[model samples]
Structure formats: C-alpha cells, structure tokens
Target chain A: MQSIIAVSELSKVYASGFQALKSIDLDIRPGEIFALLGPNGAGKTTLISIICGIVNASTGGVTVAGHDIRRDYRVTRAMIGLVPQELTTDAFESVWNTVSFSRGLFGKPANPRYIEKVLKTLSLWDKKDDRIMTLSGGMKRRVLIAKALSHEPRILFLDEPTAGVDVELRQAMWEVVRSLRDSGVTIILTTHYIEEAEDMADRIGVINNGELILVEDKNELMRKLGRKQLTLQLHDPLDTIPDKLSAYGLELAAGGVELIYTYDTQGEPTGITALLGELQQAGIRFKDLNTTQRSLQEIFVSLVKKPA
Target chain B: MNFYAIRAIYLFEMARTGRTLLQSVVSPVISTCLYFVVFGGAIGSRITAIDGVTYGAFIVPGLIMLSLLMQSITNASFGIYFPKFTGTIYELLSAPVSYVEIVLGYVGASATKSLILSFIILATAGLFVPLQIAHPLWMLLFLVLTAVTFSLFGFIIGLWADGFEKLQIIPLLIITPLAFLGGTFYSIEMLPPVWQTVTLFNPLVYLISGFRWSFYESSDVGVGVSLAMATLFLATCLVVVWWIFRTGYRLKT
Candidate 1:
C-alpha cells in the first residue's frame, strides 16, 4: 500500500549544537494509529515539529502524499492538524473565534457548521463562548484538539495529548482518537505511557537517544517478545532443587516453597506434562500453580534499556 | 493567494484592538491630544507663525506624523510580539498560509489602526485651531505610506525581539527619539545650519516634511524627495522582511 506520509533520513541539529533527531526514516500508512513511544528528550516532538513545518530539518527531506513538505508546504500543511505538547492558547479569545481562526488559517473557507461539529465532538460546545483562561485545564486541552480538527485535516499529530489529563478524560480522548482513525484520519501520537501505546496503537515505534530503536506491529511485538513463566507451589519447603530436575531450568523461590519455570511463550508443548511426570516420580507434590506472561511494559523496558 | 487566511489573521488582530479599546484607541488618541494642548495651545501662544500658517496650526501635520509613526510601530510590534510571547505562534508557523499572507494580515491591520488614530487626531486638531489641507490626496498618500512603512518596520522588530523588553527597546529608545528629532513640533528651518543638516539625515524628516507640505504647501525638503525617500524606506523594509522569511530567522529552528 502507498504511504500517506514519508520521511527520508530526516535529521535536525539545533543552533545550540544539540542533535535532536538522528537520521529518521518512516512511512505512515493511511488510517492507521502509529504511536511513537519514547522517553523525555528523545526527539519525538522534534520529529513531529519538522514534519509539521514548525521546525526545519538540517539534513534530508519529507514528503506528504506525493509532494515535498518544503516545496508544497501549503498542500501538505493543509492536510495536517497538530496538537502540540504545550497547552498554548489566547487567554482572552473565545473558544469559537480561536478555532474558527485556525480553519481560516489553513486557507479553508468559512464553515461554521464544521467548526460546531468539531467543538461538539471534543465536548467543548457548551464552553464555546467562554474565555479560554476561564476553562479547566482538561477543557483547555480539548480546545487544542478542537483547533487541530477545525480544518478537517487528514493527518493528526498529537504530541503528548494526555500528558496531564485525568484518567477519565484520557479514556474519552482515546475514544476520540479511535473514532478519528475510524473516519480515515491517520493518527501519529507520541507518548511516554506504555499502556497508552499498548491499548491504542496499531503499530508502535520506540525511540531512544535520538534514534529509532524499534518499530513493529503492536500484537506482533508482544507475541515475539513476550515470555511466559509457570510458577508451581510446592507441598513443602526444600533447601535445594533435586539434581534430577536440572534439565527443566527450575528456579526455587519462597524459601524453596515454590518452583518457577521460565519458557518462551511460542515454545511448543511447554514441557509441562513431562515436568509433572518427572516431579511425581521424584516424589514431589504441588499445591497450586499459575502462569504469567510478560506485558508490553516489560517488553518496552527491555528494548529501551539496552546499550545504544 | 490565501486571501481567506489573510482576512482571518487581519480580523483576529483587529478584534484584539476592539477588545482592548481603552489601550489601543482611546489611550493613544488621548496622549496625542495632550501634545496638541501643550505644544499647540500653551507654547504656541508665545511663538510667531513660521510661514503664513499660525504656530498652533503649523504643528498639526508634524504632530499627526509623530503619532502615526509611534502608533504604527506599537500596534504592529505588539500585535506580532504577543503571539510569540504566548506561544500561540505555533499555529501560524504550521498553517498552510504563506509568509506574505501573514505579513499582509498583521501589517495591514496595524497600518489601518494607525490611520484611524491619525484621522481622529486630525479631527480633534480642528477644534483647537483652523486647519487647511492644500493637497488632500497627497496628505492621505503620505499618511498611508508612513503608516504602512513603519508598520512593516515594526513587524521586523517583533520578529527580532525575544523578550518583552526587547519589543519596547526599538520603539522607545530608537523610533520615538527619531520622530522627535525628525521635526515633529519645530520645523528644521528654525535650527542652525549644521543641526538642520544633521536633522535632514533622520529619515523620518522626509516623511514629516512631505506630510507638512501637503498641509501648508511649505516644507524643509522638496515633496518629490520626501516621496522618493518614503518609497525607498518601504522597499528597504520589504527586502528585509523577505530575507527574514527566506532564512527562517527567529521564526523556525
């Protein structure tokens, strides 16, 4: 499938000699949620800013649709809506006017109906007449989303949209993002929250130290990296594991009251039946057992923790 | 051409003025009126007329030019500077609108605002002293040219400034001093030869001199030179603005 947005060897070196982004090449598929997971100062914001034309790249280029972002800025920018990390707004301006201002700034003709729909979708219709300063922080964030959607953009770049939002609002925002994706708008969000990416993204990209460390489909990443552990509660405590069970790579915990068996989740047979038969022949008894699987959070930690 | 974007920004800036009526309109008009009362009424009572015009009437054009220059700079500088201060400029940087449209919207609103204030001062000057404009069209021309030129200069200042103090430094330390030395109240002819020559170097003198010529048909320099100088300054400002956008100086990282 053709990509809706393409980035080729994009890099940015600021005036202060800080390299915010290394050579980054990416393709954003149409109507897919691509979550960029990175720690603070990992260049997520810089990458998005460069693509949105707020920042210029020091090397390489980017193309939105088929046109170069620099050569055809108007066409590319008209197709993108950016929700910046900061909650910046005109405190004195009313909600309606500011959002309307955004639609017009994109060279779109007046469409009060569209603006109304956006505000209503973001749950900001009731506060449309109120000054931005008078609204709550959550409402202010929603206003930012409304402003981004005001132009009916095909691609939405949300930079830490739920950074300081409460859980309830975060869920609501996720619903909004899902619906936007459903309506054929491509979403590329950057977040430090592992759960956010796990729950919302179709594909995830991990960035660390100005480099894109990994990019994979959400389920595929989980399936490939996930490990399972079978922990068995013993009938009695033992000081050491018997030598006969050495092939099983069993680890004794809880003062030898339990045995933990680590294995790949994709491994066939899991060796459980053989291990149980051997334990019974060795006169070992088990009280209870439970299985555990590694979560995306653990997988993420392991990927980012490796030496660059 | 992104005409709709230009109109949107222009209206947004104008609406800001409407919201801050006391500061944007009333305050500047009141302060300029004070100049008329003090210089035109109090001091003019003792000085004789320079040419056929009365001392009180002679300062009207100069005073209007003074206010026009100052207000043009203030309106435009603050208009663009506030967005940078508040971080709302991101929307502008990311929008589909071109730099030309941005300049048109901001400088256009700023020039229109300065023109409005200048006309109000002109109207108020009428009640205090008799007024005559020998070439009304020429007067209007000078008014618009000065407003637009200074407003463009202000846009440059706004882009160059990083802090609020920097925004004020040029308008207060440089532009205000230049306007005063540019023959706002007294004509350059009244100065010593060397001083008059030095005053002639101040570019604002041409703007004020041309504007004064339209009012009383008398000026320190020929109207042709004044108009040429005004156009030259305008062209120079345009070139500088174009370079700023081309280089993305202070606008993009």
Candidate 2:
C-alpha cells in the first residue's frame, strides 16, 4: 500500500542548538496503527509537531497524501488530526463549541450532527454544554480526541494520548483508537508504555536520543528478538553438573534444586531433547519443567539500553 | 481562503468578549463616562474653549481616540496572548488556516470592538455636552483605520511577549504615555514652539489630529498628511506581521 504520510531526512535544530530529531525517514501505511515507542526526551513530540505543522524542520521535508507539507500545507494539514500530549483546552469554552471550532479551523463546513456524533462516541455527549475546566482529566483527554476527529481527518497523530490517564480510561482510549483504525483513519501514536504499543500497534518504531534505531512489524520484532527460558525443578539437589551436561550450557539454579536453560526462541529444535537425554545420562531427575518467552518490554529495555 | 476558519476565529473571539463583558464593554464605557465627569465638567468650567470649540466638546474626540487606542491594543494583544499562555495555540498553528486569515479574524474582531465602544462613548458624550460630527464619514474612516492599525500593533506585541508582564510593558510604559503627550487632552498649539515640534514626532498626534479634525474641522496637521501617516503606520504593521509569519517567529518553532 502507498504510504499516507512520508517523512524523509527530517531533522530539527532549535535556536539553542538542541537537535530534537536526527535524520528520520518513515513511511506510514494507510490504515495501520504505527506506534512510536520512546522514552522521555526522545523527540516523539518534536516529530509529531513537525508533521502537524506546529514546528519548522531544520532540514529535509515531509509529505502527506503526496503533497509537500510546506508547499501545500493547507491540503496536508487538513488531512491530519493531532491529539497533543498536553491536556490544553479553552477553560471557558463549552466542549461542543471547541470541537466545532476545530472543525471550522480545518475549513470544514458546520456539521452539528457530526460534532454530536463525535462527542457521543467519546461518551462526552452529556458534557457537551459544560465548560472544559469543569471536566476531569480523563474527560478532557476525550475532548482532545473529539476535537481531533471533528474535521474527519484521514490521518490522526496521537502524541502520548494515554499519558496521565487511569488504567480504565487508557483501555477505553485504546478501543477508540482501534475503532478509528477500523474506520480507515491511519493512526500514528507515540508512547513510552511498552504494553500500549504491544496491544495496539501493527508496526512499532523505537526512537532514542534523536535517532530512530528500529522500525518493524510488532509481532515480527518480538519473534525475532524474543528468547525462551526452560526451568527444571529437580528431584534432588546436585553438587555439580557432569562434563557431559556442559555441552547443553545448563546452569544449576535455586540453590542447586532447579536447573535453567536459555535458548533463542527461533533456534532450530531448541536443543531440548538432547539436553534432556544428557540430563538423564547424568542421572539427574526433574519433577517438572516450564518454559517462558521474553516479552516486548524486555526486548524494548535491551534495545534502548545500548550505547548511543 | 478558509472563510469558515476566519469566521470561527472571529466568532470565538467575540464570544469571549461576551463572556468577559465587565472587562470588555462595561469597564471601558464606565471609565470614559467618568472622564466626561472629571475632565469635561471640572476642567471645562475653567478653560472655556479651544480652537472655537468648547473645552467639553474639544476633549470628546481626544477621549474617544484615547479609548480606541488603548482598547484596540488591549483586546487584540490579549486575544492572541491568552492562547499562547494557555497552550491552545497548538491548534491554531496546526490548523489549515493561513496567517492572513488568522490576523484578519483577530484584528477584525478587535477593531469591531473598539468601533462599537467608540460609538457608545460618542453617544454618552452627547448626554454631557453638545456634539457635532463635521464629517461623519471621515470620522468613521479615522476610527476604523486607527482601530485596525493599533490592533495590528497589539498583535505584534502579543507575539513578542513571553510573559504577562511583558504584555503590559508596551501599552503601559510606552503607548499610554505617548497618547497622553500626543495631544489627547490639549491641542499641540497649547504647547510651546519647541514642545510642539517634539510632539510632532509622536505618531499618536497624527491619529488624534485627524480624528479631531473629523469632529471639529480643526487639526494640528494637514488632514491629508495625517491620513498618509496613518496609512504608513498600517503598512508598517502589515509588513511586520507578514515578516513574522514568513519567518515563523514566536509561532511555528
């Protein structure tokens, strides 16, 4: 599929000389949830701001729906809806007015029906006439999402949409994002939560220190980097492992009452049967065994922990 | 053209004024009425007339111009500054609306506000003293041009200010002083020869002179020169605004 948003060689240098983004090239497939996973100060907001036309890029360019962001900003920006991380809103304005205001700002004609539907979708219909300052944190976040969707944008950039939200609201927001994706609105979210990307993204990109270190299919990334561990509860504690068992690279654990074996999840045959045979020849007995795979969180930690 | 966007911004700002009626409308109106009581009643009793117009009527144009300059700048500056302070400017910047539409929406609303207030003051002044508009059309022209010019200047101040204190610095320290010394209360002729020349350097003099001329057919400078000066200031403000948008100063990055 042709990409809906393309960022090529994009870099930003602030007046104070801080480089917020290195050369980042990304092509977001239409209708896919592309989660950008990064830690604090990793340039996620900067990248999103540049794409949404809030920030000027120091070098290179971006295109949305085949139009240059600078040359055809009206067309490009009209196609994008951004839910910024901060819960900034007009404290005095009613929810309905603010959302409608956003719609008009995108050059869209007045459509109270559409605004009503969006508010209802976000469970904000009851609070439509209420001032934004009267709402709770979670409701304000919903208001942001409603405003972003007001213009019926084809692409939505959600920058840390769930930050500071409770677990329940976070789950509900994830459902909303999923439904938006189902409706053919391309989603590009940036989050520090590994579980959020694991649960919601089709493709995940990891950025750190202004560099995009990795971008891959969510499942593919996990499978390729994932490792499995096998732990055996022994019938008897052993003083040491025999030389024959050394070939399996097994380590006595749990004060010698259990043994652990680590292997690549993608390794052929996993060497499990051969390791068991060697264990039996050594006369070691195990009461039970269990296996576990490394999670996306662990993979993420390892990936970001590397020296820049 | 994004006419809908412009309307959205304009209406949004106007609604804000409605919400803050005490500050936007009532306060300025009350203050101008008090000026009629203090300056027109007390001072006019002593100094009978200037340039053949009663002191009470003479100060009417100046007072209206004073309010127009101050209110136009305040309304427009605060209109744009509050968004920046509250961080809602992200939406404005990210929206598809162009810079021209943004300025038109904000400055247009501000100018409208000053215009309305000017009329209100004019009507109230009628209650205190006999009023005459020598050229109502010219008066309207000066009122609009001055409102828009000051509003544009205020927009620049809003963009340049990073703090609430900075927002007040120009209007309070510079503009208010300039307006007072710019022949708002006394004609430039009342000043000595050297002071009159020095007063000519003040831009507000031309605005007040032209505006006062529209009311009493009396002015310190040629009406044509005053109009040209006002247009020149408006052009300068427009150029500054265009440059701000082109460079993305204090807005984009």
Candidate 3:
C-alpha cells in the first residue's frame, strides 16, 4: 500500500535552543492506525504539529497525499484533520455551529447532512444545540472529534484522544475511531497509554529523547521481545533452591511458597521439562503452576529504560 | 482567496460579538452617551459654541472617532486574543486557511462591529444635537479607513500580547489617553502653540481632525494630510502583519 503521509529528515529546534526533534523519518501507510508512543516531552506533539503545519520544521520535508506540505499547504491540510490535545472550543457557540464552522475552515462547501452524520457518530447529535461550555468533559471530547471529522478528511490525527477519559468513554471513543478507519480514513494517534496502542494500533512507533527509537508491527514487536514465566506455587516453603536446580536460574518468593522460572519465548525447549525432572528428583512438590506472557507495557518500559 | 474560510472565521467572530452584546456594543454606546451628557449637555449649555458650531456639535466627530479608535482596537484585539487564550488558535493554524484569510476574517468582523457602533453613536448624537454632515461621503471614507487601519493595529496587539492585562494595556493606557489628548473633547487650537505642535505628533489628532473636517469643514490639519497619515499607518500595520505571518511569529510555532 502507498504511504498517505511521508515525513523525511524532519527536525525541530525552538528559539530557546531546545531541540525538540532530531532527524526523523516516517511513513504512515494508507488506511492504517499508527500509534506513536512516547513519554512526556518526547517530541510526540512536536512531530504532529510539524506534519499538521502548526509548527514549522527546522529541517526536512513532509508530504500528505502526494502534495508537499509547505508548497501545497492548503491541499495537504484539507486532506488531514487534527483533534488537538487541548479541548479548545468556542464556549458560547452551540455544538452544531462549531462543528459546521470547522468544516468551512477547510474551504469545503457546507453540507448539513455530513455534519449531522459526524455528530451522530460521536453521540453528540443530542447535544448539538447545547453550548460547548455546558457539555461534560467526555462529551466535549466527542465534539472535538466531531469537528475534526466534519470536513470528511481522509487522514485524522488524534493527539491523546483518550487522555483523562473514563474506561467506558474510552471504549466508546475507540469504537468511533474504528468506524472511521472502516470508512478509509488513515488514523495516527499519539498516546501515553500502552494499552491503547496495544489494543488499537496496527503499527507502533516508540520515540524517546527526540529520536524515533523503534518502529515495528505491533505483534511482531511483541513476539520478538516477549518473555514468558512459569510461576510454581510450592507445596511447602524452602529457604534456597537445591544446587542441582540453580542452573535453571529460578527465584524463590512468598517465603519460598512460590518459585518463578523465567525463559525466553523464542528459545527452544524452554528447559521446563528438565527443571521439572530435577525438581521431582530433589523431592520438591508444587501445589499449582501457571504461565504468563509479558504485556506491551512491560516491553515499552524496558525499551525506554535502556540508555540512548 | 479562500472566501469560504474567511466567511467562516468572520461569521464566527461576529456571532461572538452578538453573544456578548453588552461588552461589544452596549457598553461603548453607553459610555459615549455619558460623555455626551456631561461634555455635550453641561459644557454645551455653558460654552454654547466652538468655532461657530455648537459645543455639542463640535465634539460629535471627536466623540465618534474616540469610540471608533478604541472600539476598532478592542473588538479586533479581543477577537484574536480570545482564540489564542483558549488555544483554539491551533485549530485555525492547522486548517487549510492562509494567514491572509484569517486576518481578513478577524479584522473584517472587528471593523464591521466598530462601523455599526459608530453609526449607532452617530444617530444617537443626532438625537442630542441638531447636526449636519457637510461631506457625508468623506465622513464614511474616514470612518471605514480609520476602522480598518486601527483594526489592523489591534490585530498586531493581539499577536503581541501574551496576557489579558497586556491586551488592555495598549487600548487603555496608550490609545485612550492619546484620543482624549488628541482633541476628542476639545480642539488643539484651545491649547497653547507648543502643546498644539506636540499634539500634532499624536496620530489620533490626524484621524479626529480629518473626521471633524468631514462634519464641519474645520480641522487642525488639512484633510489631505489627515488622510495621508491614516493611510501611512494602515500601510505600516499591513507590513507588520505580513511580517508576522511570514515569520510565523506568534501564529505558528
């Protein structure tokens, strides 16, 4: 599939000598949900701002839908919709007018039908006549999404769309985002929620210290770095592992009532059978045992923790 | 050239004015009327006339210009500043609309609001004093040019101001004082020779003089020079606004 947005050698340096972004290159595939994961001030917003033309790139270029962003600003911007991190709406304006006006800002001709559809999809149709200031935080967020979608752009950039939202509302927001993807809009979201990226993104990009440190298919990234652990609940307490079992690198915890064995998921044999045989010969008994896999959260923490 | 975008921004701003009618329209009108009551009624009764026109009639142009300069700046500056304050400017910056279109929409709506207020004040002034507009077209010409020019000036202030206090500083401290000292209530001829020369340096003097010229055919400066000064200020504001957008000073990061 062709890339809908291409960013090459992009960098941003603020006037105060703060380097927000180092040289970075990225391609957002057509119709894919690409999640950019980063810690605070990790240049996630800076990158999005540059692509959306809210911030000028100190170096390099960006193209959206085959048009250079700087040279064809209007063309590229018209094809993209950005739901900013801030909930900045006209306080006194009704939801209907605000959303309708946003469409007009894109130079698109007015279409009430399209506006109604976007509002309804976001569950904001009921409050369309209400002033934005009167809406709840979740409802206000939906209004922002409705406004972003009002122009029916093919690319949507949601910056932390689920931040500070309740679980139920986040799920509802995810549903709306999925439906938008089904309609052929390419979505790029920046988020601190590992679970959100783990659940939604087809591809993940992890940024750290102003650099694009890792980018890979979600499942592939997990499978490549994932580890498994077999936690055995021992029948009785033991102060130390037998010398014969020390080679397996097992850890005794819960006052030696539980024993944990860590192993690489990709390695052959896992050594579980030999460890079990040695345990039985040593007259060790287990009450129960269970296996678990590392979550994306853990992989993320480990990846970001490594030195640059 | 994005007319739809411009219309969108312009109408949005105008709608905000409607929502805040008291602040945008009623407040300025009421304040001007008070000036008419005190300066026009009490002083008019005592002094009768200045330069053969009734004191009430003589100050009418200055009064209108006073509100025009302040309203034009207040309306435009607040219009843009509010968006920046709320961070809604990000949506505008990210939109396909060009910088020129954004300025047109904001400045256009602000000027429109000031124009409406000026006319209302004109009609209200007529209610208090028997009035005649010697050059109705020139009155409108000065009215529009001054509104557009000062609206641009207000736009610069909006971009330059980082806080609400800074937003009001120019209109309150700088423009209002200059308007009063620029002969909004009395003529420069009423002042000493040295003071009149110093007052000439105040740009508000030219705006009021030219506007007063349209009403009574009497002014401290030639109508041409007044017009020239207003135009020069307009051109300078345009250049500054252009440079702002070009450099992405405050509008873009």
Candidate 4:
C-alpha cells in the first residue's frame, strides 16, 4: 500500500541555531496508530509542527494523502488534523462554537449533524453550550480533540494528547484513538508516554536530537531490541555483591536484599540456570526470583541514550 | 476565504470580546464626558466659539472618533495579542484557517464593535452638546470609514504586538498622544502657524478633519486633502498588515 503520510529527508534548523530535525525520512501507513517517541527537545513537536504547517521545514518534502504539504498546503492540511499540546481555546466561547469554528476554518460546509457527531464522540456533547474556560483540564482536552476531528480529517496528529491528564482521561483518550483508527483515520502521536504507545501503537519510532533512530512493529521492536531482567530477592542481607557475581553484572540493591541482573532477551541462552547455580556456589541464596521482559519504557530510554 | 468560516471566526472573536462589553460601553462614556467637562466646559468658558460653533460642538466629531480609534485598535490588538500570550495561537495556527481569514475575522469583528460604539458615543454627545448634523448620511459615512481605517490599523497593531506590554505600548504611547495633538478638542487653525504645521504630521488630524467636515455644511480644511490623507493612512496600514501575514511574521517559525 502507498504510504498515507510520507516525509522524505526532512530537516529543520531553527533561527536560534538549533537543528531540530536532521534529514529524517519517515512513512506512516493508513489506519494505524504510529507513535513517535523521544526525549525532551528531541524534535518530536518540531517534526509534527512542520508537517502541520505550524512551522516551515528547512529542507525535504512532506506529502499527505498524495498532496504536498508545502506547495499544496490547503488540500494536504484539509486531510490532516493536529491537536496541539496547548489547551488554548476561546475562553469566552461556547464549546460548540469553538469546534464549529475549527471546521469552518477548513473551508468545510456547515454541517451541524457532523459537528454534533464529533462532539458526542469526544464526550463533549453535554458541555457543548458551556464556555471553554469553565471546563476541567481533561474536558478541555476533549474539546481540543473535538476541534481537531471537526474537519473530519483523514490524518490526525496528537502531540502528547495525554499529557497532564488523569489516568482515567488518558484511558478515555486511548479509546477515542482506537475508535478513530477503526474508522480508518491514520494517527501520528508524539509522546514520552511509552505505556500509551505500547498499549496502542501498531508501530513505534524513536527520535533523538532530530534524527530517527528506529521505526519498527511494536512486537518486533520489543523482541529484537528489548532486554530482560532477572531480579532476585536475597534470603540474607549483604553489604556487597559477591565476587563470583561480577561476571553476571549483578547490581546490589536495598543493602543487598535484592539483586538485579540484566541480559539481552534475544540472546541464544538466557543463562538463568547457570547464574542460579553460580549464586548457590558463591553462598548466595534467594528464596524467590522473578524474570521480566523489557518494557517499552525501558526500550525507549535505552534507545534515546544511544549516540545520535 | 469562505464567508461562512470567516463569519464563524468573526462571531467567535466577537463573543470573546463581548466579555469586555461593560468596559467597552463605560470607558468611552467616561472619557467623552470628562473631555466634555474639561475641554468643552472649562476651556470653552475661557474662549469664544470658533466658526460660530460652541466648544462642545467643536469636540463632538473628534471625541466620537477618538472613542472609535481607541476602542477599535485596543480591541483588535488585544484580541490577537491575548491568543499569543495565552498560547492559544498554536491552536489557531493548526486549524485550516488562512491568513486573510484570520485578519478579516478579527478586524471585521473589531470594526463592527467600533461602529456600534461610535453610534453610542455620538448619541451620548447629543445629550450634552447641541451638535448639528447638516447631513446625517454624510456623518454616518465618515464615521464608518474612520472606523474601518482605525480597525485596519488596529489589526496591524495586533500583528506587531509581541507581548501585553508591546500591545499596549503603541496605543498608549503613540496613538493616544497623536490623537490628543491631532486637534481632537480644538481646531488646528486656532494654533500658531508652526504648531498647526506640526499637527499636520499627525495622520489623525486628517481623520478628525474628515469627520468634522461632515458635521457642518462647510469645512475650514478642504475635504479632498483630508480624504486623500485618510486614504493614504488606510493603504499604508493594509500593506503593512498584508506583509506581516504573508511573511508569517511571529505567527510561524
């Protein structure tokens, strides 16, 4: 299938001499939730900003649904919806007006029914007549989402949609995202929340210092790059790691009451049995042990820690 | 830009500005009343009428337009500047709105406001000053054009303002003083030759002159010269605002 969103060799150099995006090429498929994960100042917002036409790109080109973002911005922008991180709405404006105005901004014909559907989908129907400033933070976020969806865009960009929102609201937002994807909307959300991406994203892309490090299927990214951990609860508290434990790279924790050993999950041998035998021989005994596969959060941290 | 969308944005902006309706109604009334008392009553008592018009009558045109100019610019500038201050411009920018739509919507709403308030002040002026309207249609025409010109100038100010401080600086420091010196409460012909010439540089003089010309059947300053200056001021404001929008100055990175 042709990529729904294609960015070729994209780069951004800010006026303040910061190179935000560094010649990064990326493609996003239709009907999938693609999460762009990165650290602070990692070009996540800059990349999204450029694609949304909020910021101009220094080099390279972006095409959405086959329409160029630069040369044919109106159609490309019409096809895309961007929910920015800020909760900036007309403070005195009713929720309905805010969302409707957003649709009108896209040159869409007035369709009250369509607007109502969007508000109901985001659970903003009840507050449609209420002023924006009076709504709670999460409700305001829902309004932002409603506004983005007002234009019925095929591609939606959520820039940290769940930031500063409560867990319940986050879960609510994820449900909305899932339904949107089910309805064939392509989603690209940039976030530091790995669990959100882990739970929702079909594919994950890691960006650091304006360069994309890797983009892979969720399961493949975990299985290929994830590292497992063997955490042993010590039967006896000790001052230091035993000499024999050095080879295993064991880290003493909580005054030696627990030990953590990290190993690559993709390695041919996990070597847990050999490590236990060595620990027994070294006079270290644990009543219980637990093994864990790498989480998306850990994978994200390690990926960003790597050199740009 | 589509008219429906522009109206939507315009109505949305007007609603936001409606919160200041009290301020909008009160500020001009208070200022006009004070000017009427101080300049019209106190100063007029000291000097006789000019061109057989009372001091109260002389200030009617200038006072009404002053309210129009101040309110139009303040409202437009604040409307745009507050969005940036509150970080709401990001939401606006991300929307599928064009620069022209943004300008027309904002400036249009402000122009509407100034027009409405201009009528209010003009009505209020009648209660205190026995001002004559030789041509009510002409008066309304001048009122409208004055409002439009100032509203456009205000739109440019909105784009030029970066912060709250920056927003108020031009209106407070520049526009206010120039309006004061632009023969708002008096005629430039009454001033010495050099002061009258100095007052000629203030573009507001032409705006006030155009407005005053409509009040009486005749005018001391030629109507053509005043209209030409008003047109020039309006054109300059349009070019500057269009340039700002096209360049995406401060709006885009």
Go through the candidates in order and give each one's DockQ: 0.93, 0.91, 0.79, 0.47
Q: Give Cα-based local distance difference scores for all models.
A: 0.92, 0.93, 0.92, 0.85
Order of candidate numbers by TM-score, starting with the best = 2, 1, 3, 4
Tens digits of lDDT, candidate 3, B1-253 = 7888999999998998888899888998899899889988986779857778989899999999999999999889988888899988888998998888999999999999999999999999999988999999999999999999999999999999999999999999999999999988888999999998899889999999999999999998999999999999999999999999999888777
Question: How many steric clashes does model 1 contain?
Answer: 0
Output the TM-score of candidate 2.
0.98
Task: Give the 10-residue window scoring lowest on summed lDDT in candidate 4 chain A.
Answer: A84-93
TM-score of chain A of each: 0.94, 0.95, 0.96, 0.90
Highest TM-score against the true fold, candidate: 2
Model 4 regions lying over 4 Å from their true place = A228-291, B41-46, B135-138
Ranking by DockQ: 1, 2, 3, 4
lDDT of 2 at B95: 94
Over A1-308, each residue of candidate 2 has an lDDT whose tens digit, in order, gives 78899999999999999999999999999999999988899898999999999999999899998999999999999999999999999999999999999999999999999999999989999999999999999999999999999999999999999889999989988989999999999999988788889889999999998899999999899888978889999999987877877877888888999898988878898899889988888788989999988888898899999999
Better of 3 and 4 by lDDT: 3
Q: Which residue runs does candidate 2 get wrong by more than 4 Å?
A: A238-242, A252-255
Highest lDDT: which candidate?
2
lDDT of 2 by residue, B1-253 (tens): 9999999999999999999999988998899888888888987879858989998899999999999999999999999999999999999999998999999999999999989999989999999999999999999999999999999999999998899998899999999999999998899999999999999999999999999999999999999999999999999999999999999999877
Instruction: Name model 1 segments beyond 4 Å from true.
Output: A253-257
Error of 4 at A289 (Å): 8.3
Docking class of 2: high
Per residue, candidate 4 scores C-alpha lDDT tens digits across A145-176 of 99889889999999999988999889988999
RMSD values for the candidates in order, in angstroms, are 1.5, 1.3, 1.8, 3.6
The lDDT of model 1 is: 0.92
